[model samples]
Target: MYKLMASLLLGTSLTCAAAAAPANAKPYEHVLLISVDGLHAVDLANYVANHPQSTMASLQKTGVFYPNAVTTNPSDSFPGLVAQVTGGTPAVTGVYYDDSFDRSYFAADSKCQGNPGIEVNFAESIDIDDTRLDAGGTPGKPMTQIDPAKLPRMLVKGECKPVFPHDFVRVNNVFEVVHQHGGRTAWSDKHPAYEWLNGPSGTGVDDLYALEQDSLIPGSKVKTTGSFKAEREFDAAHVKAVINEIKGFDSTGANKQPVPALFGLNLQAVSVGQKLPKAGPGDDAGLIGGYADANGMPNSGLAVQLDFVDHALGELVGALHDSKLDDTTLVVIASKHGQSPIDPSKFQPTDEDPYTKMPGYAFHIADDASLIWLKPEERAKALTAATEYLKDQGKALGIGQLLTSNQVALAYQDPASDTRAPDFIVTVNPGVVYTGGKKIAEHGGSNANDRNVALLLSNPSIPPRTITALVQTTQVAPTVLQALGYDPKELQAVQKEATQALPGTPF
Candidate 1:
């Protein structure tokens, strides 16, 4: 009778816990995630080491800092964020680049200057509709943005209409999962194109405040906050949006709602500041050198940017405290990709288009990563010629390793049957940005430095720890779900692709 009672009690407790579920299990009721583009883990650690009183230093005091987080090998924003959010790689996610090549597409609207065809360069420019009108009414504002019809779109193979963001992604994002379970979601990002962040969800953000960070169009501003160049003030607007989300009102004094389950925004200042020329139009040449660094150190401009980001974090922290949500909210500071080579002197500019030199070749080239898409008939010839050419001029061209598409696909279990897969991925030597320009650093390679990023998960309730384990950004999805008391198995990519949560998570 005693054993029977004990078993009954145990079963009762387990039943109650299952019924209570997320309400009783989760340490955090909300998650605030933000990505800092092109930031490396070493950079953040270096900043913290040098600036003991900095904003990052304060967070580092209580946060679990991962200074050796692994990003996707491609290391571009599109694939990088997908990995972080969905825990799916290029093979499963099928997202190669933000502006990537797709042969499966038949032109819907046909952005081609000539005749429309099956090939399309799917870029961010076409993601938003024409509602984006500049201040002068010329157009290109993300505020009134919708889906555009004029841009080249990948129709549903046989369908003549274009595909939406939801259809483009192969898996569901955290937003849809959380929202489905009665959680509110909100996000603010660089371009309206980032609407893709909603992932596989036909529905867009419940509260979206997209800022045209680099809009050339005049008057194309986020009425809530206007920013120039690198979204200095736009970042402030995101902070405001988050506060508003907690309070239940968007920037537009309408649609009062409940606190969002997930809310955050990306910061562009650091990337822009790091790349900003030391001198403005009238600044002294001596001062110009102060903004840029030879070895990716935090120079004057980058330091200013770092401080600015810290200030933003402080502001957000203060707001969360003011709202009394700090204890219940988990703040994440993550990077989409790390800039390479931290030593900027390694750049080898491609003075001319290398693709043009290859005779008898029909191919499309994404010069940034040296990705070459070859026609089926010309693939063998192109591959041979390209191989010989790179071999002959390896040192001069900065070809670190040129792997065939088959190798990449085979290694990742991705078949080259997909049009999104490139014929050959050219891995340039460290710091070699093949494109000719003033850019000192570039990513989009398999270089470890390019794929190494930082992740900071901070909550006052959790003990501070620094994990040096080999954690990939893909683990972020499952980790996030697990933190929220959602079964990591619910994530399609996690379940289907077998992406595990972060190894050192407190939960």
Candidate 2:
């Protein structure tokens, strides 16, 4: 009918336009990938539209912007990040969240004995002492700082072996493929647990710098993520490491090393701005963060963070130009996830009391999203009770939809087959955060605000064009490999999942 004809015409036009786009003559020598967590596609469009002279705006002039980039389901940091690097979902990557329960492992302190289920925590907790910036490790290397005793254990050849973050990942990542090809790679992030970026190889990143974000701010009585000021101070360390890497120096700047072919860092300031209830401890103490309206206009507090990030980006780009690598380097900006309840007024902090009261509930992780695991012996009885509770009290509990048996199987691997799969995946009403925390916004939900993030690819030779077709951030993996002149099939996950590069480009 008319709709089908219109769709065909639209497809034809898009194909012609893509065919007309210029192809790259040679691959870039370097790729700088940045993840500005909690940055929404709307935020990027709004910021650039309002600040025409901003660094993002300048990059957009030559960048291919995908305004409809969707992140992973559950939209938690770990899975979202894995998707970007491995071109796969949790079903293939086997990473559900930074904190998730796994039935295959033993407890962190269990020495591979007793119960088989363990809480897989790959966050600040793995640090020897999370309160210290060095995490009680040597001055320069953060991955070594991880406390083995804090990691989950698995029995291997009659010996108990601690599962490092890298070992938990199920698939090889972009870093692994690049490293295998002799391309130097480096990354900086907020936690030693991010060493998981090394993929299954455990030697993907030549240089990995991680400063714990939960560490105390020097001269202040606040954690790095406790306030906007502390978060900026924490991000500055990673930014410095990035600049040094761009100059062909090691993250510490004391050692001489070849410039990594792939290097990047994540920015935490904007995420804090979106979630923090107040600005900071000093003069900005009383100011609130989040947005002014549902239209995604940032408030004064969030605006301050945005401005800081834009300036930092300018510094990075300036360094690229000064190093004469701008022309040969491909710069990609993306976010792992986006925060919900942009209209701060919609935020509702609920508790897990009701769900816990269900007959067979054993454990659950309820953030903005909910994952429930029940006792296997009592699962049938528990599921019935829980279903009735949601049906009767869903409105008061801020419940939107409950995916129990068949529904969960349709979206992912069946719970009956996958022990890691939650028996119930509960998606709440928009803006309903399942926690006792004071933050106005949260991620890790099924809502659009949680999954739609900004994605941009910029190179001096690439033309500026906004791609409106819906794409997943998972495409970033193959796209990056293509930009570096490598076959995307080199990535195991890319081959397993059939992930393709983003359209509108010839790589």
Candidate 3:
């Protein structure tokens, strides 16, 4: 009873004398967090300015904008999203990439044994066998570079367990923070594995919905850019889930559900659109691919995506207004990461696998550099050789700078301290797009173009203004706490790291 009383007080009113909610007590009863993957602040500014009637434009006029918001380093969706949910960097959260190697974790075959180490790819792959992490395309349409055999995977403790999205993360998220305090939560994203956002409680979202777009779907329908029509259609289920959840009903056909205190979904349409090739007949032109102009301005493909996201936002806003929840709900629109090498001429691909040729070291290469894990016996020797080899390769290998094992440990965390910390971090130049597969433009680096994403938060009470001061997505977690009336310290990561609430927010 004491806990319930506290929840009521912190969530709504300050009236201690009476249990009744004051007439103006409710400033915000619901918080909606949305992420548009691969969206840049510049894209938001550009799209809104050009598409004035769009939901984003409307948000610009009334919502607080972060013109200089940046995502966590490595700028991959996994690490980037972890920063938003956990309020910390890779050091604080133990998250660096979706497909990263862990020195302490052994392969499934060697689980719990005196296993050396293993590579772990935390994606939709962990969900089910033959999960088809890259399945799409219509019967006659072209196909993407989906090779099931090539998809990254690893068994854990000699068993195949699904790596829930939050499994690798080392801290709590807003969902768990709110749920434990008597608040309801819901979320939807690209894969069932996204169940990770639920935080450490392992049940952060009360009404969780996830879909695997990369999974194979049988039909004449093919995917567009980042996903197929069917994929976007699946994500729509998440949008509908939020609407229903707001009405006190379960999105999974259960009724009599309570309104969620926090809820949101990812709109992948923009990401897919940004990567979508101008549909055509030759040069794999029929296939959906993302390419940019020399100046990095998006062509029609990305424009379509921007409009789609805005339209989805408008629909959700309309739903809120229809339910009379608009005035009481807080709307947040942001991105998991930003797409990079925006200039068309900047995309470059290479297959410089020096580690595979060596005996004691293995590596995962992406975004023009490699994340290397050395054998326990030769850690020092391999580190030196790999660093020197890549350094010598120089622009020929498209290498930029190598963050040595010790340098990374000091900057991120010691591998001895954090097994998730890769031994070395290789960063490529801006125009360099290293690929073993199809994606032309990419992210997952410390560069500004890769990490500069769009972020905006809104409520009826907030006076809209664009903020140019540097802000980190890590600030959103604690900011969410403060906005919801919870003690910012309620978030362990926020408390330990001293993450600040977003500036200019009413809270």
Q: For model 3, what is the error of residue 171's alpha carbon versus the real structure, in angstroms, after optimal superposition?
A: 1.2
Maximum-lDDT candidate: 2
lDDT tens readout by residue for model 2, 1-507:
563232211111111111112224437889999999999999999999999999999999998999978888778888888888988777677777778867667877787777576567798899999989888885357656899888888889988899999998889988888899899999998888988988888888889999888888777877887778778777878888988988989998878888888889999999999988776655286667899999999987789889888988888899999999999889999999999988877888887455777766667777788777776556667777866765787787788888775666666667666767777777788899976776788888778788879999998788899998877777888788888877777777676667778887636
Top TM-score hit: 2
Off by over 4 Å in 1: 1-24, 111-124, 127-144, 155-157, 217-230, 251-254, 281-296, 357-368, 376-393, 413-415
Give candidates' CA RMSD values in order: 9.3, 4.5, 9.0
Report the error of model 1 at residue 58, Å. 1.8
On the 0 to 100 scale, the lDDT of residue 146 in model 1 is 42
lDDT tens digits, residue span 1-507, model 3: 563332211111111221111122334788889999988888888787778888888777778999878787777878778878777777778877878877666554443356445676755555553234322321101112222333333466565443444456788888888899899888777765565676777778777666565655444234323343544555576677777776777665467777788888887866765554454211224434454564446666566556667777888888888888888888888888887667767677676454565435765657644666766656656666766766777667666777777777766788655667887777777767666655666777666567778999976667779888777787777667666667656666676667777777765
lDDT of 1 by residue, 144-173 (tens): 464456344654545456655446678888
For each of the candidates, give the backbone clash count.
7, 0, 10
Q: What is the lDDT of residue 446 in candidate 1?
A: 62
TM-score of 1: 0.83
